[model samples]
Target chain A: MYESNRKSSIVNIYLGSMKIAYVLPMTWACGGISAPLSQVNALSTRGHDITVFAPKDGRIDWFPLAAPVQVHCEHPVEEYFDAVVYVGDTFAQHPFSSAGQKFLLLQGKDHLWTAPAKRNELLQGYSDPQYHILVVSGWLADFVHGKCGNPRISIIGNGIDINRFFPAPAPREKFRLLLEGNFPDRNKNVIAAIEIAGRVRQHFPVEVWAMARRFTSAGELVDRVFLDPPSDEIPGIYQQCDALIKTSILEGFGLPHLEAMACGCIPITYASGGVMDFCKHGENSLIAGVGNLPSLLGHVLHFLSDSDLRSQLKDGALATAKLYPWNRVADALERAFAGGIEGKS
Target chain B: MRILAFTRESYPSNYPTSYILMHQSMALEELGHEVHYYQQDKHPLGLTDYLNSFSFDLIFLDLEFLRSNPLLRILSQYRRIEPIHIVGALYSLPAPPGPAWEVVDFTITPWKGETTSGLAAQFDLRYLPLAYSDRLHKRQSASAGSIFVGNTTGNKHKEAGVYLDELIGERSVFCIGPEFTEKYMDPFMLGSLYASSRCLPNFHYSWEKSGDCILNERFWQTARCGIPVNDYSPLMDEVFETGLLEHFCFADTRIWQNRIRNLNSGAETVHPALIQKLDDSLKEHSYKDRMKQLLDWLR
Candidate 1:
């Protein structure tokens, strides 16, 4: 009976030709914007009319309409969309106050214990059974459930484009390393990696390359550090790198780790946040204690001295990256839509 | 007048809130008031502790601590001796209760105007705008940007590092806070270096949460130094209406990109006219004057 009910609900959505709207905080080159765009691409292919309500930006590549995706600038929510996906924090007062199915694709907890007004808004939004909240990591999911009191939560890990990042030729005699993202981010912990590199230089010749909008003095220690003007040559950079060191203090999900892994770069990350979800401590990548300067330095030294260990981590990281393809994430999102339709009926 | 102020302990490396509170207490003392600051943890357990130290002309309670414990009920007993005032931004706590809400006399928040008005109504407490000490004013006039403070950790919402990254892209942005370790040193110092070359020096509070916009000393310091801050709050308009301080919507990368591009185009320099307008506005809404106005309501 449940299966039959689910089938009818999906049929109702299809027969009614329900339109889904995704409200994304349109930004350039950030994980929040890219993740949603990728999901939209995948979902649009599955025949759902997906309209992305985001801030207008010139940098983002416009999605093809043939794939059932439409990008609209954020505006009043007067027009009815079957499902509304909020990518980030919802404004205190939504202009188009409507009783529609709301989906929160939470990246992290921003105003969780502070910002009372925002918390209240999220509480109200979550209480509505029609709302389906999805968090990127288990820690964030637990936080949403504990703080927002929303029991109905899902964990949809972020995905990477495997084709963009593929294995490179064997590393040269000197180990080439790369780190990406907003460099100053405390969670990224690029400084720790640099410190570890300094210590590792005792053993092997190490060249660190950082690709970010900015770089720090420690990042300057690298052979080459590229700033904000992100190059299209990123794939080549990843391939050349022997390993990607992530020493972030905290993360909702480590996207760069996955990206680097996809490029066949060994990942050595501090064991915290969502890194544990993807990387097994010894299997896929080297997981060190967060802020353990000595251990991290030791791990870097180990990777530098032992080529066999680096090779193992590289292969494992590549294997782990395969499990989280964009297509699979898109399929999971489609399944969520199907579940939402089922509940409506 | 003896004033008993209750708040969190001063962790030297903590945000300006604790430092601001201490500085404000000292300023209040300069105005012929004896200020006694008490951390929530220092309060002795049981009824005897309260009866012994409940006498004061004015009692300033940090509402953040009161909400977590039954201290408000205990404090209500001494309402006659001390008129309780709750100060601090209301973090993640539930809406104030109806009957219990009357215990608080004044609610000092970082928010301004309507946001403050709305919050005051919700808690049934009188609202007072935040005050900046004279020390901060002195710091503001200093042209050199030697200190690069970034939020390396603690609060996630502030996204201070994110802003620093944009401002200090390829430039050095400095990270200063309790959470700063060797790990964050690379990105933090790099941001500092990048910002150092530019006219504006980059500094971030790596440990503290974002402050509400009430044109406090920090905002002035950033503006007076000709450093544009990528403020996330709407209250920034109320504080700096003349556009002296560059503001960017937190999630809007285009705004960041445009600002960077403008900076590259040599439009990054702060105009004297804009600085004059900001200074003039701040003088008009001086903390002392605002405090006097609030004190009048109490009278």
Candidate 2:
């Protein structure tokens, strides 16, 4: 009788642990989806047993799990997970009827211009009152709420690891400007940056460092372009740069902007999409109008000529970075889950 | 009658085949037919059991699966029991002989015209037109610019990279396919090239291989954004009217360049009308209605 009671107690304790299932499309590689990996890491640390349900061959870290939880391949299976967080639109049609709580974390709507059928499924499927939608930016949240009619949507800005990206002492001599993106195709507005850099170089000694895997020869217009060598050195590059510029046509959330700011580098970015949610013009980062070469160049020049402005922006950026620490973000996520689960109950 | 539609399972990355099957199944259910989905991984259908189970009124099988599986032989065994609808990229590919002769009742090919009759003779097929879900219809009504859809890599024979590189330089081109692999291709570079234009090209394609058909969804959504599509397949014309899409035929450099120029310049083109005609023909014989008709014929 005592043995049976002990076994029952152990089973109850095992069952009591909150089982959270995360469904991410791909692994971290500097795209919009990569921004959430830090949060996933933070959430895992909080004792909320987490299992990431993703593609069998995806590069996501599965070793962090305490014990082997059910990581079912490519199918919706009934599990004891208390919450399911889907990181992309691929799981938009996934049946959440079995899960305790369903949440969608959208980084960006990549195929929004196309794939109406999939978008409709996502919008309709998530419209269920039981599901909670969390977007990285207000634009994304508003779009989802308005299009899908889901009232429980929340805008949870992406959090960065402040420790990984905290400010380094300003480098002496030639001002270093870093531009990093996984895909630095025409849209990183790399060409425009190059053009602006060229204009700025005539006045000041400017050196541009680009961290990207796929850099077209066409982008050779820039003087000092560096291709991404490996993943480990990304933090070092961020630490070395004086300012980071993100001129993408649109971003779900600019992680590099936050990462650069965390490292105490001044951020010069376009005022668009999720960047506006955090980057206030002249406060934390210099905001330039999208695709405006003159304005983008103007921001770059202001930081280059005025050391005091750069110093102020650096301080402001590092200060702002504190607000979006991974710990705080994880706590907010836990709160969201608690509120959602409690409300549903 | 109860029907079971099967495809690959859902994942975080969007797979186009899964999307297509979901829409088709939903459409079938909406037409007052019972539909159940048996995914590849969830509950894999073995040949004998799949043939024996519940006696479905109809079964729609993706051609890619037929190529990959030995189930086609089992399908041939029960060719007389009920209607089997074969859907997917069926352009001169080797499939099981028995199923080709007797198992497949009707075939839905992405390619158009008497191409159906040829496929029928070889695989005992009947041509069926493609149809989009109501979701696509709504997206089309709201679209603003041209949405170009195609993979960076061409199918087994064609080279999509060559055409894609040239096309990327000129117009706003968004890519939807598998994730960017170093060995395979980079989807992000493709996306950035497309998003470079004033129009914020959204990259919403799933890198997941769940087998959902995102092509149709992308077509309608692109249309919703008022983005005319510069697609590679002739099949798109059949599913969406010429009024809905801007079609492009793949060819060598010079021909492709001319077509791109004509499309960009908004010149009078026969391609648009041809697509519209194809759409009109398909509208008259919708895939859902046709599938029902074929099943009834078998009954």
Candidate 3:
């Protein structure tokens, strides 16, 4: 699996136990919220004193977090961390100015959609010399470097919890196709995913299952919809699905496809930048040009029809998942905090 | 004195600026001043020919109007020949106060910040901050959950996030934004929404909060609705009488929720001191006061 490839190649840099404060923009259940929390949990397991500082609503029931969460609530954030890591561009300038080694985690191209003044404020952070830019995908690293002209970037791609998301083989009556993410976001392009599923259903006895945070008009097309299911139950859903289809136009590092791969589900996705890190077209994943519905539908049809191809790709998917264990992600994050991050991937 | 005011006509539903301008015009009219409103679309015309239609003592407009319509340069030249005093309400400017501001005789801002301070240093600027409309904003029986109104169609999805999402799902919170509707609500309907809500959980737009501790016109209007306003800003101290809104205001959402709960239950009602302060500030900061200030400056 990709985990073995990731584990064998990744240089484990131990910078000893360091005090880290993971600054959460909100205590929500999206990839931006989960990625940092997952890293915090993994690092805490490695005996680091990591505390999650959220601006408001500190109770995170979605992800199982090992680190303690401190809701600063209007009060100034504590300034005693060895490294203060901020994710995305939601908060004000210098949120933890006094806190030690500052790192800004670039999750996606979210700033493009914000108000012009606010967008400028977000982009300003990327160019600031005080912040060490850390991104999930290599594409994002290039984005910051090309856009902001900043060379200090580290690519610490998101990790999957193998323990939580592993293959659970079970007899299925019908081939199930899965879709996940917040459908309402225009960037996610859930309508395209639904369209692909509807087209797939016409050819085969396919039951389209969707795990979404919000139900939109496109959601009506999905056969079975799960709204914000707990993290623990996600693997079971992935295991039952034969293929996971994602038609997202943009992704910082598409985590769902990797998680599905870990659960032995073949990923049928678009060339959504971040997914290109692991999703090798016609090998591990069936990746079409972004927004190309015909090619996506063709790949799904071919994968379902050819059992030999399915077996080979499933193995490829498993190998891809083996590369991104949470512990390794935490190891890279520790190096990033210690100012030992290798240059952008 | 005859006053000609230019304001934006096409404001989306519940836009605070629309209500602010409405109240300003109403106050001017109430003060026995002859005020003629020339409402225009977002892309306004200077309408130099239209200006010739009226012989006015003073012309009132937003500072943004000067930046948008270059034809206003004709109006600036007309200002030299005519005995008309041009006043611009400076909420924000795209660029620094430049030659465009030369057309404006006086500048007024409803904010106290470095921006206003810098402008004050360079120009004839007055710190005439936001005030509630007593004629419109009045208390009514409220039973619904806490509410906030802003441009949710934009990046507010990122800003409001879980706090707004959970409230929208769990409570009777009317988190109305542009995403809900594009129709502009009349002042009465807007006031009703404020007064009917249990509380106003005020989250400032990033620009509003950036360096400048400026309170929105919504804050002043909502305060008059007799609902607890859980807001953030050091400007609260500057705007309100000492310790008047401190207990009612919160910088944290947890404490904000507590304040809302306290108001919802019989445990807490609108504090007598805050009500008195709002009443006193209502008259003190009203558009009447603003108009009187403008007249006083013109004299």
What does candidate 3's lDDT look like per residue over B1-299, in tens digits? 66766756422233445556667765765575545455544212225533543356888888777775464776777888788899888776443347757788888887777777877888888878777666667778777766666642332455565345555655535666665443233443566678887777665655666666577777777777756565677877766665766665777776666676566555767656667776665557666777788789888
Top-scoring candidate (lDDT): 3
Which runs in model 3 stand beyond 4 Å of their true positions?
A1-13, A90-94, A218-220, A340-345, B1-299
Q: How well is each residue in A1-345 modelled by candidate 1, as lDDT tens digits? A: 111112333233443344777776655666667788787776677666777665544346433223333444355677777777887765333434563566778775444333678756766765556567766777666655664677666666789878777787763877887766556664465766776666566557788888776676643467787675443466677888887878765567887788888888877776545666797755677665444444445456667767788778877888998898877666555555556666631
Which candidate, 1 or 3, has the higher lDDT? 3
DockQ of each: 0.01, 0.01, 0.01
- What does fnat come to for each candidate? 0.00, 0.00, 0.00
Question: Which residues of candidate 1, in runs, are more than 4 Å off?
Answer: A1-18, A62-75, A91-100, A112-130, A216-220, A229-231, B1-299
Where does model 2 sit among the CAPRI classes? incorrect
Residue A228 lDDT (model 2): 47
The TM-score leader among the candidates is 3
Query: What order do you get sorting by lDDT, best first?
Result: 3, 1, 2
Q: Write the per-residue lDDT of candidate 2 for residues B1-299, one digit (tens) a residue.
A: 55555556521123445544555554564465545444555332344443343345566666666654356666665654545543333433333444443445555653334544455576645444444444223212222223344342222223445444455556533334432222221221222223332221222222211222223334333333332333334455445554444343232445555554554455734444454453443443333664565466556
Error of 1 at B170 (Å): 53
> How close to the true structure is residue A17 of candidate 1, measured as C-alpha lDDT?
42
